[model samples]
Target: MGIARQLVHRLEQWFELMGAEYAYMATDRSNEASLRLFTGRCGYSKFRTPSLLVHPVHSHRLRAPRRATVVRLGARDAERLYRSRLAHVEFFPADIGAVLGNALSRGTFLATVGGYEWGGVDRFLACPPASWAVASAWDCGGVFRLQVRGASRLRRAAAAATRALDRAAKWLRVPSVPDFFRPFAGWFVYGLAGSGGRDAAMAAEAVFASIVNMARGRAAAVAVEVAAMDPLRGRIPHWRRLSCTEDLWCMKRLGAGGGGHADGWDWARSAPGQSIFVDPREV
Candidate 1:
């Protein structure tokens, strides 16, 4: 039975009843049938294409440079930072505080390199470091399970062997592969932002490494989504083998609207921005 079309219609009706102005859905670019269903039949237009960057969690801890200070932000402080620094970024959520405060949320963190004191948000923002980066960690494992499909026997055996070796030798710090064959949880990085410069890139790399290190044991891996043109893309550390270069997001106006825009500004048609806020709930 062709239920997808009917489901889309019902969802749109529900959206309208909920006073939603728009609705969007994401799918892999290679999903031809999904693309056709949403774009041709459901009237959803092509929208944002962001890359999903993933890094495997290692058994060892990765530390930021001695000069850099990593701060774990409280929900209120994290909300303040996002509202002030990322308000204009695409897909910035209004209930960020709620998201940050969710049980599944690991924490929000900021990495900075300088001789500054943590007086509070005001002091940090007032005298921001030359290279600073912020990110939030969401424990996706608690929400749902993910399994990797179609892996060959050899790959699985190799992964198992590597994991065994790492377990046998704890001092080696071997990069063990996750058991993708089984349902496992992974950490999702959201609200990634940073300043501009080589130092900023280093700081971002440190932040990503730190997240991966922190996620070990609890999560099999850590992943983050960013726009192609996002400045932080080149800075964040990820494995080319594990990351997706492009993930498609399609959007449609639920109510009578002018090209999915209120004042002649379509989000789908807008140019790619430097930064993006990847909401874990949506991911």
Candidate 2:
């Protein structure tokens, strides 16, 4: 605790000199020590808790792949797309040029159909008024795998019970993941979206299926993050009923505020698991 406070103080001083407006950090509820240090000493406040959902690519999750006119763009084109289409998205980087310039953004993709196209994000009100979901895989084969493998004995046992129940559900012809939960390497479908009635959504789905096929043997799973309120949340396929952690966002406003307090921030009052968002590059 003492060490963290010192480190945070130093970082705050550094950022202040750099003329940064605010500093952000996130921690799950289970991390009591981290929460205390940031809130108690660092002068940060609770902003919001968003559900982080992941979709693992597998045979079962391979729903019908619709065919849409999809194009993989170059760095310059992707950067242009981010700049032109994603300005109003909440939590989006103000300087997308910096983000696109970062080495982490391996590639950019765009999907178009039915006279509509989505380059960066698919925003919706509470839920998308339309329908579409994307599929891809990531080469994230280490920590993500470790998380599930390193579960406690009790936690593993609970998973076993769930597996048995899953089998029973499948026997009754109900929707269930009969294979338990197996994982592999995969790609990610980030900033995938669509609009303008059924055809457009279907086209987006087709494009996603095509990507999934490309990742079939080369990757273990693809992961994407969506807010709970995102209409596409229900449409995106994934390991059904999967458990995930919720990260509570904490932030401190610089010189412009009341000792960097963030209690009254609009994002703080948002419903947990709602409006979860992630840039594909951060996937």
Error of 2 at 19 (Å): 3.3
- Over the stretch 50-157, how does candidate 1's per-residue lDDT look in tens digits? 999998876666555676677888999999988998999888999998899999998888888766567789887787778888899999998899999999999999
Q: What is the TM-score of each candidate against the true structure?
A: 0.90, 0.61
Q: What is the C-alpha local distance difference test score of candidate 2?
A: 0.53
Question: Candidate 1 — which residues are off by over 4 angstroms?
Answer: 1-3, 63-67, 149-153, 257-262
Tens digits of per-residue lDDT for model 2, 30-74? 888898888888778787665555444343335543444555666
Best by TM-score: 1
Highest-lDDT candidate: 1
lDDT of each: 0.83, 0.53
